[model samples]
Target: MNTLEQRYQFISLLGQGGMGKVYLAEDTKLSRKKWAIKEIPLTGMQRKQVISEVEILTKLNHQHLPRIVDYYTDEQQQHIYVVMDYIEGTTLQEVLKQKGVMDWKDTLHYSLQICDVFIYLHHDLAEPIIYRDLKPSNIMITKQNEVKLIDFGIARSYNQEKQDDTIKLGTIGFAAPEQFLDGQSDHRTDLYTLGSLIYFAISGKRYDQHATTPLHHVAKVPQELSSIVQKLTKHDAGERYQSAAEVKHALYKLLNKHDNNKKEQSITPMNIGTVMISVIATHKGMGSTHTAMMVAHHLNKKGYKVALIEANKSNEFKYIEEDYDGKQHKEVQTSCFSMHGVTYYKCEPTIEIATVIRLQYDFIILDIGCDLNQAWMGEFRRSQLRLVVGSAATWKKQKILDFVQQYEKEETKDWVYCIPFAESDQMLEIKSELRSKRMYAVPSNPYPMKLQEKTIAVFDEVLDHLPLNQKKKRLSIWWLLVPTSLVLAGIYVMMIVRM
Candidate 1:
């Protein structure tokens, strides 16, 4: 077999069934799109069955159904390759097993929808079809709670003129009686299996839910549908529903009755905010660390509880300098949080990102060196942001700008915000350059502790771009404390308030 892992970028193996294995793989030929690749080992009649199912599913264009996108045999190896839409969501079997059944209304609602799916598949197809296998695992629910019937591997088109065109294949306990005896099946065979399916659904377990109950004390099937249930399980092939449509209509009617007693399915949307990831990239001598630290520090002081992640390994100790000429400590009333100048470096930039993100910080700004395609840099680009910071040199700015533009053309959401450094007499020219590049310009001045008016305004602009859902409150500003009479007096006032 052609190991798909050798060629295409492959995600994890999703499932391994009796027929084959399904993998979530990336199709580079399809513009690096995602596809669910199924590798089936064909034997005797199985190859024919796989080919026919692929042909049928390709023609199927239902929104709820998964469509087959590509099909080709790997002649070098000897297996058939089938690629289809990789639908998201857990299986119905998983939901039932995990949630431990459900309320009568929920169960009825699920069964009712499954019936509708059968109706759509049978009546809507060019030629009516019969899904020989109807089991919980085969039916999947989307993230939106929309029902989807999957695994068309065993489905076959119905024959009107021919009488005995049945096949001997289906799940054992869930199969109709005639299917076990012989291939004496038709659309009615599907209906019988569906009835068994509903029986399992209503009972809130497998068909054998009440298997251990005493035979004399077993719950009785209703008089109206007792014969219908018996016909489904009848040893004789002659005794069953005429078609899948009949069974579907019956289940839908029950569904309406169930809905009349209570409300139907309700799906609520989750709250998604504007959380983005950005990497700060620059040359080795460009002072990218200082720029990144200043940006994070400015945003944090302006009424936002921001998180500063140290993405570089070299400057972890230098940035957190223990001695800073008594300037790191300053006074500001609006800065309600720890106003000791900076949160400093905490994120130890390692190859292992899973360990890095555990220390939660709001804005994860990665300070990157000139190295573009390193392992961790690639991982950072895959993040929500990839920022390139350049210095006063035009070539440096141009190189970084070209990188951002190329990335932006490929992905619109990825953005590159530029910041130029100017500590000399060329401050006015630096501002002009920033405006030309359509970027935010910063004045080379004393750090934020001086609480300058211009620096504070710039902080507000960064705050606007920050995550808006942050909850704000007065912060405990005692991270660094020197005992004094003032502290005692403050405690006294707090004690009186408690009283």
Candidate 2:
């Protein structure tokens, strides 16, 4: 049919599967906006199933999910049609076919996006929705590098009272053990399929639960990420990650660790440029402002132009001006002061990051206070590097967990955690609990102006390729040569005196 509902006009056939055909359609009533029209032949029970799918799609409102605009049944033709947003992209299956295998970073990015959709379905709704099927063909990647999940034919809402699903659904290799074993598939089932999807994305091969080979052994995947995949694909649902949030957090930790390694390896004397670093505290009294100031001064002393910005509502910079400088400056949109060769910008309601970026400083440091509701989060996300100043105390550790979990949807690859006054063992414990290696124990600095050796060492490790550290290494070599030369001169003078 050329037109349905007297509005959607069929343009071309997009694709066809066992269920039905999808067509590219244009809305005649509107400005010819494109949409995907799926037509499935009505059967004994399929008409009700199609209605169920429509209900699920209508309730969804996520960037990665398609919007169901219209749906109707063609009684004369015995077919049901669904009109939805036309996702213009290639499926993961097509990408895998062209490239054979995807890079781990690219796979991780897509996986994280899929997890966001899962979280919306499983936890954000009144009734939990279990996406019974997840495979490469169901995932689409746009030209702008965005992910979209398609094909909800097998999706179903979960019921806690039910002991088992009415029907067994899902692809063979990608399906969880419970899906095939007559057990009720739940949120963990989707996670199991996600692990298989990741394995297939990185290895260009299906994950065989029976095979002794592991994911890392088959592909050039990181052991930590591969281990997460293994945990996700465990035979028992209880053994797998219980929720998509947990899986997302584990993936975030892996991505952060990998990115830290790459950054440390890539840093060199020639490539040093304007780097933005954001410092945020998990709670009040976490010393985030002090940590930011110390970092600014340290970088400035290393012969780099540094700008320290107060992007939060703490007004610590204003307090410093009144107490230390003996003058209180009125707060405006932005105010500036200088201390220890570091330029400080007191920003009210947060200053434009672009404006500060245009000044072209070697390093721009933002101090984001404990309030997560502030507008400075945009700047924190835009910054090239992030430092989370949190407590290492066991009781206060929950704050750090909460902070990270809150932003689990964002990219955490460049994030580094700094715990003030934390012992080495404490840092180790937190790192292990979070499954992250991008953590540092910051020593207390009473005088922010003075750069202590311990503080310098911590910064040196966190921010690799410091000019000061390089100069010290050169000086150390000369230090060894100078002492040897003086000893030789003394021995020569003694021999001359004897002669």
Candidate 3:
């Protein structure tokens, strides 16, 4: 066991990859932190690809994920290793193969928690996140059965992918329908995989009788957990959970519903009320930021105490090309963030959103930064609502709807509401589609253009455009759900909690 601070510190090869090797290293700095360094073979294009991979992982941090502590090159082979929280635990696949399926309760408990991890990664972020792969080998379970999902080599910052890809990429047993067809994926694809994992948990199989028709197969799940899993695994995005928060809620409900009299665990649960939060999402440059600013401006003009939280990196260090007094000035820092004369807060990673609730603001418009790994995004789940923004084009509308449905189903959460950003023609199509799906009052046609304006300014017009008494999914402090719901296909709910 040689210990040195060199690049090849104690070359005990932990694992070998096609790209290169994973070495177990003793970090000389930072208290000799143990890191699993992934070294990519240095070739012509390999170097560039390695660089891009490192950039993607360097900025990511989540409770269920490993953080990238360091990245650099050592010797001829480019060293691109991510310093992760070394898990001495065995991979779930290994555990299952060696130890066999544990007690049903234990298996269910573990699988449900794993669902939480994906839920957090997807809807919990300001920008939607997508975990393209879900399988036993990729999941790790500790001695205490805590799940830590790893291997983001192919993950993207997204919650959903609308329209299947022409080609599919996933392990045969675990891939979803859309994945196999190269169709669109979103938050729901991960849920489908999750449902499959749970199927392995409750029963001794990886998939149910009709795994493809998950919504129909949902009734086989045990208790209220069935609702959560069915919704998450719906074949069509329209019938699924819309966000990770919703999934969390379903988990909470299933977990507590049974033991209403049981004592609850330690919780300084987020104090949230009235104050709403919505993220305007679209392909970058679709003017979502502008829409958010417009809504905020309109809300402010209506005598409402509103706050617009910007997750966009551009919000800070923004550039303004101005002809101030006929002199061309590029990149000017201006206070143009306030949505339509409304008071807004330009924020960073660790934000105090509780203050907004305490202030009793009637509304808050947030620019859900498309950039993944935002600091303030985790806090937005405490908000009263979410507004998804996309153009009225059929493709865009379908994408948004697909995302919401997937997120909701996979997470088993009900959205406060969904409002699509549309153009006039798209709005007509959207209206017809919404009616067909039994979802009414699809957002207004071409609400208002605030391209050169802030996104919050359009809040007022969007609000009025909301249909009479929007559909709201009632929330519970602790959403306790069962895990066998998918297997049993029943909406059984009971609580065992501190009442």
Tens-digit lDDT string for candidate 2 (24-108)? 9988866676889998787776667767767667667655677665688885748889888788889999999999989998898
Ranked candidates, highest TM-score first: 2, 1, 3
Cand. 1 TM to true fold = 0.48
TM-score per candidate: 0.48, 0.55, 0.46
CA lDDT of every candidate: 0.55, 0.80, 0.53
lDDT for model 3 comes to 0.53
The candidate scoring highest on TM-score is 2
Candidate 3 lDDT at 401 equals: 62
lDDT of 1 at 317: 30
Q: Name the top lDDT candidate.
A: 2
Query: Which stretches of candidate 2 lie above 4 Å from their native place?
Result: 207-211, 264-499
Cα deviation of 46 in candidate 1 (Å)? 4.6
User: Ten residues in a row with the worst lDDT in model 2?
Assistant: 264-273
Poorly placed runs, candidate 3 (over 4 Å): 1-5, 8-11, 16-21, 40-50, 73-79, 102-108, 111-116, 124-127, 159-168, 207-223, 261-499
Q: Tens-digit lDDT track for model 3 on 391-477?
A: 556556666566455445332142322344445565567556544322222344344323223234333334643431223321221
